[model samples]
Target: MRNDPLLSIKGLRVEFPTQDGPLVAVNNVDLDVARGEVLGIVGESGSGKTVLGLSAMGLIDRPGRLTAGQVVFDGQDVTKYSESGWRNIRGNRIAMIFQDPTTSLNPVQQIGAQMIEALQSHRDISRDNARQIIRNAMVRVGINSPDERLNAYPHQFSGGMRQRVVIAIALLNEPDLIIADEPTTALDVTIQAQILRDMRRLSRDTRTSLVWVTHDLGVVAQIAQRVAVMYAGRIVENGPTEKILKSPCHPYTEGLIASMPANALPGERLHSIPGGLPQLSKLPAGCSFAPRCNYAASACNMSPKLIQISSDHAVRCVSPLDGGS
Candidate 1:
């Protein structure tokens, strides 16, 4: 049986005010996270992956706002929620684990104190109960000697351990949705694998939906069952993980796949996508990717909306690749 998605984000446009004009950081996009699944948002830096994730959680900072579209969670349209309403939803029903755990965590406070506060912020629970929950969560995330660790400040833990603690904090409420932006970026490869595995197992055990935002295709590929490839504030392609990675249609998606070392031959010089990312303020009139696409044509000058390439795959390019080099 098909499971209804717990979150549906449609036409999500994010804009920031500039001296010249408004800048679209996250163009019109659509995304969904079922009751139990990890949706991967993959792209290079400045590709709108993190921006879109932030928009979903209604945490856009100053000068930036969710200008257009809807952020619907659990069958309700959250976009209309007042600031206080949104605040109530944040960190209780939906939480985010930002890229830099060090910065996301409070520096001066001990881990236990911050974690207890996070729990109490959402639930009307006692400090001792919150501490017990924190300990259980710490052990759940593989932290040893929960009591000793809880007393330690955020700076005391290694990068990996800190990240895990951040993950535990996010999971404290057993939220239906968790947005993890580059959670594994600071860790070594082995540690990255272990953390990703832990996230996968925990998601299954807890029935929480996850949106993993990262530039590492390898990490997303490892944990996400569905993939969304974004570039220049738009989603260029999205589909099942196997189909999108093995048979990417959009030129940008193809370029990202081609750049992966796994696809390169031994002793071969690495291939990078041609051309630099266009300035967001000076975005082109035609296809945003036309500057780098090798197969550009006059028809490509027209803006293209995401069109289905297969039963479950979609591409935004007028002329997508035909599964070949």
Candidate 2:
């Protein structure tokens, strides 16, 4: 992996303006993705993994604008750029694939049309050239009878096929960064594995950095070079995947590992973390994870910074090494 980061986010805060007050979905988040690296952001449903991914691409719009922080992409502060600057980078330099392809794909248009549009929108290639490129992309994604599938609508394809098309669209430009939000959630177990493998292999071959946003730790272990555990909108712990999964330091991280259905402990009782995520409208003052953190102490009441546990790892809570929830 490259020592210099491709994307860097610092003090990033995203809030939704409401009648009562502002609702903070993502708060005080800081992360970095290096070139040719896969950084997995793992968390429960409401922990803001999806929101954080969207914000990274400067995709937050309208009432849910970024409150504070800067997104440094290759040394440039993308957060400070006007609307046009973001337009230039999005889909061209950085591409994103969402969980539901149906939601992002056009139902009226054929698969070929959508992919061709994506190519032409970002590149100066002619329609004929773009069509050829799209076919090659379909073939690269393991699609058989690529020519026939090209004319089919989104509804005509299986869930896995649609996702592969979505991925192909994202890869059409060979972007430097790709952020996938639950890209495998809609597929079956077998199909999920295939897509995951294709994604990892393609990313490595192309030397593209990826941010895989998902609640699935198993997927993280399978494809990510590093993992960041998020809770209540903040990353509780982050480090190399092998190190963090093998020996988690944060309470939240520990619970997630113990509760993994894909790789549960042998002959050990499976334990789930108590309490659900807190309401965004009324967040806890200190560490947002305190209510569910078994290691909560008096110091936890005063918000803790991300403390370094080792050279490559950092945990948000004051005494994260004490453990468990």
Best by TM-score: 1
- For candidate 1, list the clashing residue pairs, or say none: none
> How far in Å is the alpha carbon of 36 misplaced in model 1?
0.7
Question: What TM-score should be assigned to candidate 2?
Answer: 0.94
RMSD of each: 1.5, 2.1
Model 2 segments beyond 4 Å from truth? 262-269, 322-325
* Per-model tally of clashing residue pairs: 0, 0
Tell me the deviation in Å of residue 17 in model 2: 2.0
Candidate 2, residues 1-325, lDDT tens digits: the string is 4577899999999999887698887889889999999999999888889899999888888889898998999889998888888878888789999999889999999999998888887779998899888888888888988899989999999899999999998988888999999999888999999999999999889998999998888889999999999988888899999989888888888888877765566877678788888988788899888898887888888988999878889998787774322
Among the numbered candidates, top lDDT falls to 2
Give TM-scores for every candidate, taking all chains together and pairing residue i with residue i: 0.96, 0.94
State the C-alpha lDDT per candidate.
0.88, 0.88
Residue 318 shift from truth in candidate 2, angstroms: 1.0
